[model samples]
Target: MNVYISADMEGISGVVHGAQTEPGAREYDRACALMLGEVNAAVEGALAAGAARVVVNDSHWNMRNLRIEELHPAAELISGSPKPFSMVQGLDASFDAALFVGYHAMSGTSPASIDHTYTDAIHHVWLNGREVGEIGINAAFAGFHGVPVALVTGDQMATAEARALLGEVATVQVKEAYSRSAARCLPVAEARRLVREGARAALAQRRGPLRFDAPYALKVEFVNTGQAEMAALMPGSERLDHRVVQYSHTSYVEVYRAWRVFYNLAGAA
Candidate 1:
């Protein structure tokens, strides 16, 4: 089996504050180490379960948190920032399964640590009128590639939210949120054990490849109207409210590209 692991930092064990996930802070170094450890555990577990290949994408803030040399020898790593697919970079219609490790919740989710979707500038994202977050969007990407999201590990809220969006996938809660910036985390070792177990179990039940719903419709609400107006210029995007723009596509790739345009509007402003 070919497995793809998208790893984020905020929900990693021991990450409890903004500084922990922010670059250049002393806390960030420790957090990165923890994130790396959890990722290694996931990769190791996949290998133990007869995975033919494993790729780990460091899908955090700057996307360069993982130490390449320190990564597992059996796994390939994709790490960088400003990529076209952002968190879902390197994804395509080839993998058998995907795993999201150390993820958080959507923006405004109560008790979630370091919660935000894509960028803090955007307030919410909806697909076919249903609310979603990084988990949902990435799962859509995985689905587009004809791969099932086999497992996800993160904070309790993120796990719950992901389960709600991608029915029956395995999930591991590494922490319980106290707020957007804080959480009550499991010990790093315990969290890694759970991730390993979840990964093994999820892959055991992996069915046929999954695909995102086609003719996708997406709506995005920004923190400001300027962002929405900027996004509304995309061919099929329409202004739906003071801060929301909705777009429809005949394919998941189109919707993914449209979402990229919407996310970039704020940067252009």
Candidate 2:
């Protein structure tokens, strides 16, 4: 079986501040090591379970955080940003399953370390009026391509949030959030075990890709009216209110493409 792992850094163990995720800093370096270690652990588990191939996408800021030289010899890394699919780039229906590693809660989630959907600049994001976090957005994208999110790992809040959206999947909590910049983390040894075990179990029951039906109607609410007004300028998009704009498309792929355009336009001005 082939598997894809979309790895983000915010929810990695011991990560609690901007300094920890940013590219330059002692904490950032250490955090990258932690993130890579967990990713390797997941890959190891998948290999042990008979997976023929595994790919790791560095979905964090700038998307180039993982150290390629240190990556598991058997795994390939997808790095960089501004690609057509962003976090979920290179993913398609070919893979047997997908995994979200080091993910966190949605924007405005209380006690989730550095919580935010796609960006802190936005306040909320919705698909058919239901609020969602990164997991929801990325899951929707994966589901569109016929990939089930078999395993997810992050902090307590992130795991809980994923469960709410993806009930049947396996989730592992590497840490417990105390606030946006603080958390009660599991020790390195224990965190690795949970992730590996979860991955192994999740693959055993893989029925099929986690699919989400859509003609996806998306509503993105910004933190300020100015951003909303800017987003509304996208042709055919409607201003739902002072802070939100709505759009509809025939497929999740189309909606995702529009989401990228909408957010870029909103932030441009």
Candidate 3:
């Protein structure tokens, strides 16, 4: 089987502060190391489960956090930004399953380490009226291409979010959060072991991909009216209110693309 892994940083083991996820912050280097270890653990687990190919995508901010030299040799890495698909870039119908590593809860999720969905400007996102975060959005993208999301690793809230959206989906919690930037982290060794085992078990179970019925109704609510105004500039989107923009399409992929555009536009606010 072929496997795809999207690695984020906020929910990485031992990460509980914004400084740890920023590129040049003092703790960023160590956070990257922790991210690498968990990613490699997932890759190794996938390999042990008889996967013929495993591709890892740097899904965090800037999309260049993982170093090629430090990655598992058996897996190929997708790094850099301006990727059309962003977090779920390089993903398609060709892969058997997808794994989300080091993901946090959606924006406004209390006690979720570094909680935010895609960007801080986005207050909430809804697909067909159901509120969702990065996990739901990306999972929908994978589902659009017929790939199931099998394993997700992160803090307690992150794991709970995944299970709530993808019933019975496998998850590994590396920390328990007391606030957005405060968590009781697991030992690095133990966290890696849990991630590895979670990947193996999830792939072995092989659940079906999440499929949303078309046409898709995508709505994004920004933190402020200014952000929504900027997002409303997208040719095909509608400003539903002072802080929400709505877009629709018959295809989930198009909706996903529009989502990227919406947020990028909102970033200007």
Candidates in order: C-alpha RMSD to true structure? 1.5, 1.4, 0.6
lDDT (10s digit) by residue, model 3, range 163-262: 9999989999999999988999999999999999889989999789998999999999999999999999998898899999999999998999899999
Instruction: Show the lowest summed lDDT stretch of 10 residues, model 2.
Output: 206-215
How accurate locally, in lDDT, is each candidate?
0.86, 0.86, 0.94
Residues 143-188 of candidate 2: C-alpha lDDT, one tens digit per residue: 8888899988998888989888888778899998998888899998
- Could you give candidate 1's per-residue lDDT for residues 112-224 as a string of tens digits? 88888888778988887779999988888888778889888888889999878888878999899888776788988999998887888888897544444557889889999
Model 3 TM-score (2 dp): 0.99
Candidate 2 to truth, TM: 0.95
* lDDT score at residue 5, model 3, on the 0-100 scale: 98
lDDT of 1 at 186: 95
Better of 1 and 3 by lDDT: 3
